[model samples]
Target chain A: MNCLLCNCQLSMRLCITELFLPIDHQRETVCDACRARFSAYHLSKQCCPGCGHPLNGELLCSECQAWKNNYGQFLHHRPLFHYNEAMAEYMSLYKFQGLYQLRMVFQHVVQMAIKQEEYDLLVPIPVSPTTLRTRGFNQVEGFLEGMQFHQLLTTIDDHKARQSARTRQERLVSQQPFQLNNNVRVTGQHILLVDDVYTTGRTLYHAADLLWQAGCQRVKTLSLAR
Target chain B: MQKTDFYGRRVLLNAEEAQQIRIPNLEIMPAVKKNGDRIYCYRCGQTSSCDTSHLPNNQYYCPVCFNLGRSSSLACYGHLAEPNHFTLPTSILTWSGQLSPLQKRVSQAIDQGMTNHQRQLLWAVTGAGKTEMIFAGIAHALARRERIAIASPRVDVCLELFPRLQAAFANTPIALLHGRTPEPYQYRQLTICTTHQLLRFYHAFDNLIVDEVDSFPYAANQALLFATNNAVKKTGGILFMTATPGRTLEQQIHRHQLHVHYLPLRYHGHLLPQIKINLAPRWRKNMERGLLPLTLIRSIKATLSAQHQCLLFIPHIDDLPLVEQVLYRQLTNSRFTTVYAADPQRIEKVQAMRDGDYDFLITTSILERGVTFPEIDVYVLGADDSVFSSSALVQIAGRAGRAVTRPTGRVIFWVSALSRSVNDARRQISLMNRKGRCLQRELSSL
Candidate 1:
């Protein structure tokens, strides 16, 4: 494998002796040349702590600024891919087609985005039963394999309040907040929520609110594509 | 976004897994599976996929974000693709062509009445050639350029009848839609599908004919019936085919509210099958562990010595292997094979038997209906077991006498108790044959 930028051979480079050394594959791949370049890339420019849009910080993206009056504040969110044809087909096959091999493809893309990024936990957005039934496997969970699991960052809303709301956003806003199972401790913990594609950030914001309310110090999201 | 952690033993997705897509207005969810790799939701029917709602009343619902949804019904991906055979009837005539006078008359009434009415039920008796009766209706609708759909609850039976239906009509396009097949038949003139698959059509089919309406999976779910109706074209027709009508339909039949036609006897004049019962000690238990309760074993051996063919029907799929093994040991000299729905080689094994390669065939209720054997006597080792409903038992009994020359055969229900299914089966057949005799006598007088 050759680096897209440098054309340097991108094989896992290590001496036979380094086999016993503790290492992170992501760190190895985020080479000095690549890491330094990625750090400066305009795509990684600072944005609102509440949203990952181009930030003048004068106002929040409509999703974040008015979210509290509606859903709530998101500490921050990030996406690796723009919602496009490649990611759509990739996620479709990953979720619907039951293409297990594509997990490696997803992992590679996710790994590159998360390079040197720190989070106490990486939560996967949950898939519903209806969706899971249609596709034998959950593609979000499919993409999350071999990665750390965390608390449910998002959830559906109130049992009765949304007795009238039909839109998915209404469903999300009205949904009861999703939390981790009984055993996990997320207080003061920073999290990296992972998903296949980045959609309207309502699901992510609600997930952040739940974690924040549960005392998580920070909540960040990372997806295969924006 | 929130960080969520689940203490539940997380999920694993493997190759060969059935995946249901989250998309609506698309038949894209992975097929629900009885056995294969599947990731189930916390709610629903405790299978792959689930209703997204949780309840405080201790009822089953989604455990995660509460989204109200239905139970986890298994997904059927649709039918497998087979080459379409639409050749018009030529030298190849149908089984209906050989129907007796009474059979023809009753079938004609059913054909005319059912298609004439927009919504009606038809209660045909156990030995009635229901499929044969429907050919005229199917032909009538086709002649008017109307689309027709004939579906059954059992996939195995629809598969058995598909080729037969294709053979009956010439140059008529017929598509057999089921879970295993992928393509939707938007263009085909005729469709035969399993009832579970009707949910996918959503008003795509016209002239919906549901065979075995009072059967499982569909029987328990009212939504299935709704879905069946939903599959039909507006102002279209529904013709339900059943050996035994339910209480409501029976009442309708008595009131002449339902358009019912009866074929009391086999197409050819054959006596109703003889039912010989033996109350042996846990016959199935003895048969397992290679012991066939001496008495039953001896009877089987005696039949084998006479060079007669036999079909052994066990009650459950779980008992199939043991039943097969025991029968194999006892009838070592006979050509025999076992087939079941679970066995991928099922079609192959049945085909082998059809080819006259096997003298003895062991099977389960999967072959209880629609399949025909030349002259094989059937032994329902656990016939009186609760699994064999009255209708199922009657259908199984009908299998013995479908072919004219093979009309006379032995049917043994080696059971511990006289189950209602067994008794009802006996009564229904006896009553039908008695009706047949009365009709014959009336005809002679006329």
Candidate 2:
């Protein structure tokens, strides 16, 4: 089967993207694509196992994640696929198009794009109840349909963008960030942050920023489509 | 928005979601109220807004969500590449345009694999013209805008292959990547590279081919296999072309587990080239004192009379120059060139021979691999050369008969001593020839 995530074949075990599919390639278990996309991809290695970064071999953005103690851990929120016009169109029918059945494909491609990683938990990015009622579901939550689920952390606070409108330079200058639920704590745990479409990557950046602040060992992001 | 205009295919999910995503199929996450904090778990429908909650360490769903599970199985290279992109073509090597048994079987396998998008392995023998068989599949994938990469061990082989493939599909954007070439800047659909160069790519091409699959660099290193996997695009086609498949591959093929092709003969009604052993051990060792090896000296003169350029392979650089000097001395006015390691003039010398600058060329193992001349009589002084690998010797001999005049040559191996390698080379040549003839007969019958 074509993994919606990494687009790798679905032969063996279920990759992270497999959870969204109805029938996998082998027609036995899930596939590797989904597992890779949703698994704790960021925590797979010590960031030291290889001379290069541990997050993703393709994006060797983190050369020093191991030595640095804590500065909002991710090297850079560099999403794998290009969220171009074509991808955006796929997302329109996929993200906002209300074709919920398409979530399985998202999982497949994402899984194909990424591979297996070691992480503490797969945390679906949380949304507000009011927002969920209007949208009918948390975008990422829909991907976890057939996946094993968890209740690790809550999305208690709605983070704000640093500024309303600004040039690229201005936005880079403003730098306001996401705030998580302080009542709950997630310290020194590998965090695989699941989301839907990776548009600006700012939202995932803000969310992961909150995660690292809580002392999480690592934070990674995966979306149905990018 | 796909510029060329692709219809929006609203792709659907398969069974993976039910198995790997979440078994029970609850796409909606329930909000819960925990100590005044609102949280949710998509699996159990438990949220901070709900009354019940589970501990963080409690085993509820699979590990990915909780980040506490295994891959469930070891993922192989076939899974990383697209299965549907592989299509072995029925070879049209000679003008008759008939697919050999090996070509037919391999093409069927690749076609099947590409259509199903599944991983597969294809095994065959040397001189099988395995490259020609995959051209149809590769061309198809390229037409579809899918990416492809054909990789092998030696650059010389790439030198021979690239031109042939380029001719097959005119005016396509093809890239031959190595340390010298720049990486594709926004546009490189099909590529060729040495395995060492593969480490530079990561999930890029849609179809991956490891030519001479049993050859070094690719077979000896697990990391190379990993690198090939990394360079290929997700769900791409993977094809391995090899002659002497290792025991592991042989077992798979014997069990009918791998996709296989077996083209044993040369195209165009040509017979497998012939080999001859020159029993001149004593003559070679004692010829150092300004004396010419009678057997070699005679063969060279007779070969010249036949209007054939001769390739005399001596094991050492010292002997190559010595042979050139001796041949010059023996024939008085005859012209000859020597090509060996560190011969800064190697290319000039090779070109000189090609341009017919000299009637003979004495070379080292450098010419033992690629670069074929149609009608060359080849002689190996140290056919027992440890430096001469089995594949290398076979290929050097293959350079003979490349010209239609004599679809073969007088391959004389002058050995000071007999070694296992010499026997191996002889055995290999014989077996390959027999297989080639057998296949040719079969192909003709068909």
Candidate 3:
């Protein structure tokens, strides 16, 4: 098999794990060099209870504290990776360049992260109609390939620009863009809002606000990047 | 958005606009296509079985061409018969530089091709002033109020050509587009862009000149060839400029599908530096043991003693550190640097070599064609290695004897054995020299 990114042939050999395990679980999309470029967030690192930004040893970061102060509700958002320059480039190629094959690079890790959580349902942030037409795949939903997710929210605003295209101030001041579908019912369930990145947190907050209004008992969030 | 924004532009539409926009003569733009479960972009077609684009119910956007803006199945192309703007310059050829008599003749031929909208190949050798030869033809097309674009496969080539073309046609508004450029693209009389950027244009240019058509990934890519054909109007002209024309192009010329114009001689009227082969068996093993071939070391010492820069082209990038280690011990007093394609300091290192900061640059074939350095000798270690193609070998030889001041430089192919590619490259260089001699004789007679 060839590496998905570089097209170099992947040298696969039967290992000790193959003898013990009947089924093969190795699904490496990127070469070791490419995989090394991305610095994955260690699960052992101490993170802010609200947004999951790594804090060396502190219980809560200033940003999450400020978030708690602004909105009475605090979201327990667990992010898988830190938003570094390498991650920025990765996102630029995967999200902006629309290289859909890149989604698989983070597939197994994201699936494992999702499996660790015990949310009643997964609610991926919906892309606007314009984004749906232009980008084809919703980038937020792209990482959750084999995972079960509920597309219970749809974009209600057509004029709103993408969160990625807006500035931090613009994203913060942006109005609500999503509306819950008629069939979505989480009256007493723990709803998990998933997104690709947590930039200003306003996009997820907007989704959470509508879900709370729709009578969800509690709301937590998960993202690939912070 | 206003209707004017979409005019003569490739834009995606929502489900409502896809059904409602009924512009006459509109077509499902060839840029976007719907394959079974995935949408194949007529642009950058990246085929992977797992297409995740969740377009609104069966619609698809080609993720491959997303860098040039999105091309999706739900989009429709609305093209104007002619560009909305055209301003003919009073003096199109603003540069005061002179072309050689042979170049003038070739320039006239290209101008005539532009007049007749013919597909012609300007098979010029490296350092033949290929860019300058196109000025007269571009001026002709500009005076005719036709849209023109000079596309190359390499962004470095496009970047290098943009300023030169800009200076040549001082009055013309030129737009340059590439993958990493932050400048927003706008319609211009003369557009200079990488071949990949041509996907965004639809029948946009009347005179399309493809420079370095033999360079990769454009030489081997059918999609880019299609983009080139689809970019120009049906009646538009195409002039291909290249130092090394590939087999397909040769076949096309023989079949009379492509008209050929030869400018085999460099503007300096010098022959290409012929390649000299020296065998060094078990060179890799020798290098691993810190043993250097005395002949190769002698060549490097001679080139350095002559106060000329040299490029040592290794077959693989992995061989760089080992080669550097061996060379550093032998030539400790000399200033030499190693670079490869992904070297972080590749640009700076090449610049340093050009700026006369380094005596020699040990590199891979990444610096094969786009770069130019004066009075430089070239040595290719492992020339018999399959990593070096025939065209690449020719280009490597073309690197020598490029500058007008020192138009004769040494090019040695140090190899274990003479490969077919090496022979073909040697033959091609000598063949061009013979053609140059004939052309020179013909010019003198005329």
Error of 2 at B284 (Å): 6.5
lDDT of 2 at B157: 66
Q: Give per-residue CA lDDT, model 3, range A128-216, as digits (tens).
A: 87766556678878788777899988998684577778888888888888878988678888888889989878988888988888788
Across residues B76-128, which tens digit of lDDT does each residue of candidate 3 receive? 55444445477677888898898777888898999999889989999989877
- Tens digits of per-residue lDDT, candidate 2, B1-446, equal 11111111111122332234332222222122233433333211223321112221221111111111111111101111222332333432222346765576767667666554444565444355667677767766665666677888767667677887777755565678654555532235567778755654545666778787655545545556666666665666677776555555656767866565555455544655656776666655565766666888889898888877999887777776567667788877667878887989988888888888888888888786556667788888867766665556666676677665667677777776777666766676676667767867777788
User: A84-159 in candidate 1: lDDT tens per residue?
Assistant: 5545655554454444334544466566566557977878877554444434455566565556675454343332
* Cα lDDT listed for each candidate: 0.60, 0.56, 0.81
- Predicted complexes: DockQ each: 0.05, 0.02, 0.38
**Where does the lowest 10-residue lDDT sum fall in candidate 2 chain B?**
B68-77
Docking class of 1: incorrect
Candidate 1 to truth, TM: 0.54
**Residue A80 CA displacement from its true place in model 1, Å:** 24
Ranking, TM-score, top scorer first: 3, 1, 2
Model 3: docking quality category = acceptable
Decreasing DockQ order of the candidates: 3, 1, 2
Q: What is the TM-score of chain A alone in each candidate?
A: 0.65, 0.55, 0.90
Best by DockQ: 3
Worst 10 residues of 2 chain A by lDDT: A43-52
Per-residue C-alpha lDDT of model 2 across residues A41-74, encoded as one tens digit per residue: 2434433232223455543333334313334244
